[model samples]
Target: MNLLRAAATVSSYTLLSRVTGLIRDVLIARAFGAGSITDAFWVAFRIPNLLRRLFAEGAFAQAFVPILGETKSTRTTEEARVLLDRVASLLTFVLIGVTLVGIIAAPLVVSAMGSGLRGADRASDFDAAVWMTRVMFPYITCMSLVAFASGVLNTWRHFAVPAITPVLLNLSMIAASIFLAPRLETPIYALAIGVVIGGVAQLAVQFAALARLGLKPRISFRLKTAWADPTVKRIMRQMLPATVGVSVAQLSLLINTNIATWLAPGSVTWLSFADRLMEFPTALLGAALSTVLLPSLSQAHAAGRKEDYSALLDWGLRLTLLLGLPAGLGLALMSEGLVSTLFHYGAFNAADVAQTRMAVIAYAVGLLGLLAVKILAPGFYARQDIRTPVKIALAVLVATQCLNLIFVPYLHHAGLALSIGLGACINALALLTGLRRRGVYVPSKGWGTFFMKLLVALAVMGTALAGANTFIDWLAMQQHAWLRVGLLLAMVSGAGVVYFGVLFTLGFRPNQFKKGGTPLV
Candidate 1:
């Protein structure tokens, strides 16, 4: 696959999903705001989301794809089909058992995560968390299947359907929030219902797409067949290390959630909101590049095309840095204005906006680190080497947990954001350094020059935006809040124009960067 072409396709769909998600979040802020219910809902929501990233997107895809891609490349179609069926059967069995356990332990899980909520005035407050967790527990089962289908579709070179599936999930939640939220006694329940419906819908969408490609998976009990398959054994081998790596990250997040429980009633919600905001850019640029790069790199490595593999890795890194750096700077500089413009309305008040803005700024500081991990991790995964990342991830997890312990008492929700950012930087550095030691990554002479130019352009853009924001604030003092929003939007647009224009004039071809050229921006 053409790496640039795949990234564009996935990025476009991911961009759409992020936009719809923003709308959903805006509506959620309007309805629930930052309070006990929002906290309860977010805590419940994070359980599935953390699991989604851990088991489905992170470990499963990282482990399954290389094996699947190799199978598709080396074996006959019939042989690959049999392998898929066996693996699917085994996955179904495991996920069923996991989901049952999750449902049974929902209350204990919620209580452990949200011990801070016990101080609430009403006894029902604790029950809300339990209810929401149960409602959303089945989501894990559905989405795990969806993730399996997505891995299969990705191997078949049908990227659009898998990339677009998340859009359906976001839209389902949006619809639920709009139509069902007001009618439900507790708005959290509406969001929970949306999670279940969305997960099922996501699975259905992928199945239909697979059927169109004549690759439908049959339901079967073939655990013995899967366990005996050599390919399955190899996948399991890869999965064990990758699971450790993903679990380290997930455990760090769980630690953050636990720390947030002691901060304030809405501390968890504030952290969640900030994370969603940062994820908008991360998902669009970082995730899009990583998702597209993995299969391409895996193919190149499998074929022993070292140059192509290296080129793709370099391209992914440059694109991630170019896109991620500016976004991080912009968010950090304009956190307050951006947060106020987007969310300071309805049930979300000025105080909530202020708190979330601080969290966003803190998260912004680590955006490059986050994107770096996204870019560099694929190199390891594509080489079918998962243990290195697992070791690095463990170190980063310990660092993050230590930071959370030290910072949360002083910085509140923002402390969690800071810890995550610091952890990402550590993880990225470890991955890059490991790749260098293994001779997988050799920085070209042009790297320093490219980075220097990109830094110059970023400085110019940041300065221009900061100035523009000051002017906008001065003008907004004499205008309505809506007018202030309009002015702020104009200021942001102007900043982008100045930023890209300067880079282009400085001999940077944004298009070439997208196509894997040196990062000049």
Candidate 2:
């Protein structure tokens, strides 16, 4: 399969998900605004959302996909199918227990996640958060299964299903926000309901795809039998270190969320909104590319094709810089324009936009680092070396908290964003160094020239974006909403043209990526 084409397919579908997600956030902002109520919902939503990342997207995907590739190559079809059944059974049983615990302990979990909500004046908000948490807890189970199916499909070279399934969740939320938020005594509960509904829809579609491909897992109740399978045990063992790595990241996020709750009324919501903006490039470039790279990296490693493995990493790294730099520049320089245009209406006021803009600018500081880690960490994961990343993540977690102490005192929520970004940069550098020391990856020829061209392109793009920011006051343009949207679009489009045009003038060609697989040009 062409790597570029596969990545494009994933990115395209992911773009749809992000667009729908933006609409969801926009509606929520218009309806609810950034306040204690919105904060309650955001804090509650983070629970299942974090677990979805931890289990479904993070540890499970990392541990399961490598082994699945091995099974398909080394085992008989019957054995591979059984492996799926056993793994799925074990995951299902475990998450069901977790869901039950989460529902029963909703108050405790919410308190731990956002202690500020526990204040006397904010007692009702805390209760609302707990209530929403209970309602959304089941979302984890459905999403984890969805992740299982996504891993299966991606390994089977069907990337579109996994990429597109997220749209269901976004659409579900949009519908609930529109139809349900106003009807209830507490409007946010509708979003929690939408979470579960979306999860079911995503899983149903993914399972349907898996069934069509003859890869659907037969979940069983025999815990003993599923646990006894050596491959199942092996995946569990691999998941141990993978979980630690993922948990460390999630733990940092939990701490950050808790800190945000204490700092101000809407800090959590502001940072979360800023996060929605950041996810666009991260999802489109980083996630979309990594989704295609990880499975291929595993396959290449299993076959003992060292050069192919290195080449794949090389391609991902170069592509990350080719696109990621300009993305970061756009984000950092056009923060006011982007934040205001997307979110500055109704309850999302001028103050909210300014606060969110600060966080967005701070996040842009580490955007490239964040994008690079998506490529570099897979270099370790594909080799089944989860321990290295775990250790690095632990260190980064400590570093992040320390930075948070210094930053939170001054920059408040934006400080948290900055710390997370810098920590990502640190993690990416460490991962790259480890890959180099292990002789797993060596830089290819023309890296210096490539770096120089990117620097040139980024400078040109940055200047264009910065100039465009001066022409219109994003906040002042709010009454003329369509004009703000038009100006933002033209600015971004013009910047992209200038950036790539400079790269082409300086000897960059889109067609160069097609030599191995897929024409990215």
Candidate 3:
């Protein structure tokens, strides 16, 4: 696959998914508001959502993909099919028990994730969250299957289907928030039910894609045989560290959520809204880059093409800094406008906008780091070196909790977001350092010049944003939604023109980014 084209493909689908998700959040904000009920739903949704990351996308995919790439590259089609079947069977058997246990322990899970919900004042909210968590627990099983199938599809270079599968989740949740919720006395449950529906839809699409690829994963419970497979043993071994490494950022966020629940009634909701905005670029660029990179990196590593591997890493880092810096800066400068324009409607009021904007700015500060980690961590995972990243992740997680103690007292929810950004930055840096120290990555020659150019471009963008914000008055534009959207579009377009225009003048060309078969040199 051409890494750039593949990444653009993934980013396009991810953008669609994120756009639909924003609509879902808009409806949800209108339907539930940013109070106890909405808080409860976020908490409930976060439970399974957390695992969906920790297991499905996090450790499981991280471990599965590298192994799958190696196996597919080295082994016969029949052998690869057998390996896929065993992995699928093992995941199905394990996650079924996990989901059942999660359902049974719903209340405990809720309490752990959102201790603030268990307060006497928030007892009803806590109970609602528990029920929602139970209802959504089964989603983990469906999503795990989706994750495995996606790894297979990605290794096979079928990117579009798996990329678009997330759109189903957004569509289902939007439908739930708009249609199903209004009919229910407690509307949050509808959103929780939507989680399961979305998961099933995501998995179903992947299965279809797999069938077309002529790959069928037979589900069996013959644990001894499956477990005895040497590749299965390696996956489990890698999975152990990969899980912790992949999950540290998420674990820190979960901790932040736990802390936020105690801060104010709308604390979790504000953070969630801000995070949703940050995720637009994070999911679009960060996820897409990582998704494309992992398989390419693995292939390069397996082929022992050291320069190709290092060049890919260099290209990705430059592109990340190129896109990530401006995205973060733009979000920070335009946080209030973006939040107000998108979410300041119906039940979401002025105070909600203010709080959410604060959190958004805080998150935007770390956008570069967050996006970098998505690319950087894969440097380790794609090489099947999970331990170093885990060590770095552990240190970052510990430091984040410490930062949380210092910042939350002053910045509240925004402080929590700042801590996450801080952790991501540290994690990305450490991963880069580890790669360099191990001689696994050699920085391209133009990096110093590239950074200088990026700094200049970002300065121009910042100046442009400050001037626009002076007259735009995003909050006032809320009364004229079209004008708000139009002006916002204008600001983004102008900023993009300045940033990329500068890059072009600096002699950055589209041809610099070529298909994966080509090296940066």
Candidate 4:
């Protein structure tokens, strides 16, 4: 089908998830605020989240999707079905073990990620974190399975299910914050309970979607039989380097989390809230486009359609700049307003908004690069080439820590965000260069003009935001919550209109992005 439409569909669903997620965080901030307890919960949640990304979404999807696409194209229907069952069997077997280990070693895991939690004054926070970690540890099992189903469904061109299922988790958290947190002796435990419930809900929905397509795996417990399958072995082998690549990113997160723990009491929570805001554009544009592109790119490779392959990458990059730049400019210029509008409420106060705004601005600096990496890395993943990106990621990881040393001393937690953003830009550049040198991706014509037009649009958007920032007192308007929300929405929407209105005048058409043939599944 039309790739742009697929991306738009995924983006639309993702926006719903993001909206619900923001509400979840808003409820959280109102109830709990950015404090030691919230930091504890965020850190504890990171453990299972780390495992899910490492084993399923990050490494596993990168490795599994390409091979599954290849299998669907080259093998019979029965062969593909068998491949799915065996892969599922092997994955479930592995993640179960990881989950158990995580539960039993919850204390060590929490300490490793956030050592500062162990101080005598923070002993309660440390214990609470461990308790939550154990409760949420099993979340990875359900989420990993969900990720498997998502990759399978996306490969089958069922993008809406995977994109929207995340909303279940957000809703689960929101419900717990409202209904469960108040009744509990330890309210934070409600979030952990919510995490498990959400994971299971998401897993259930994903599997149901798979069943609708009759593509659900017939999971087997026979590890030997699954391992003996050549396709399963290939996925595991591909995961080797893919895991390393993903690990580099996770490692940075682990380091940053630990650093945040040591910086200030609310640093982790502030950064987390800021991160949720940044994810709006990221999930909408970067993730949506990449999800649609990866399968199509794999199809192009399988069919030996070189021109189609390059054009798809070009189209994704153009869309990245066209939309992502305006988003970044809005975030950086009006960060205080955005943060205050969304988060300044009951428990969350002016100081928290100020701190969160700093991180948002830092993150916005690298939004384009972050979006670019999402688009470019899939270029290698679709070709079943994970090593180049892994090597580049290792270097970026090193550069990030070095930048952290230089910036954190001055900028505090925001420095951690700044370093990560800068590192992502470096990583994207290196990936683009590698793709060019290897002749895997060639830049299409009009790139120069494309960027020039995007720059002009971004300048206009930035100017509008600067004007809003000066005239609007976001922190002072906290008492007028609804009015602040209305004003923020109007300013962002008006600026977005000015941005895209310029692009339209400069001749950027939706038709240019309407490339890619019917998806091959």
Q: Write the per-residue lDDT of candidate 2 for residues 380-407, one digit (tens) a residue.
A: 8888889999999999999999999889
Candidate 1 lDDT over residue span 1-521, tens digit each: 55677778888988888878888888888777898778888888988888888888999999998888888878898888887788788888888888788889987888777777666573476788888888888898889888889888877777788888888778899999989988987766888899899999998989898788777778787678779999888888888899899999998888778778777778888888788889878888898887777777777788887766777778888878777888999999888787777677678887888899889999999999999999899999989999999999988988998887898778889989998998899999999999889888766558887888788889999988777666555323333667767777787788788877877887887567555742211
What residue pairs are clashing in model 2? none
Q: How close is candidate 4 to the true structure, as a TM-score?
A: 0.98
- Each model's TM-score? 0.96, 0.98, 0.98, 0.98
What is the C-alpha lDDT profile of model 3 across 279-389, one tens digit per residue?
A: 988988899989889998898899999888888888788888888999999999989888888887788898999999999999988898999988888888889999998
Q: State residue 447's C-alpha deviation in candidate 1, in Å.
A: 1.0
- Report the Cα lDDT for residue 511, model 3: 71
**Per-model C-alpha lDDT, please?**
0.83, 0.92, 0.89, 0.92
| lDDT, model 3, position 243 | 86
Off by over 4 Å in 1: 119-122, 474-485, 517-521
Q: Candidate 2 local accuracy as lDDT?
A: 0.92
Candidate 3, residue 16: lDDT: 89
Which residue pairs collide, candidate 3? none
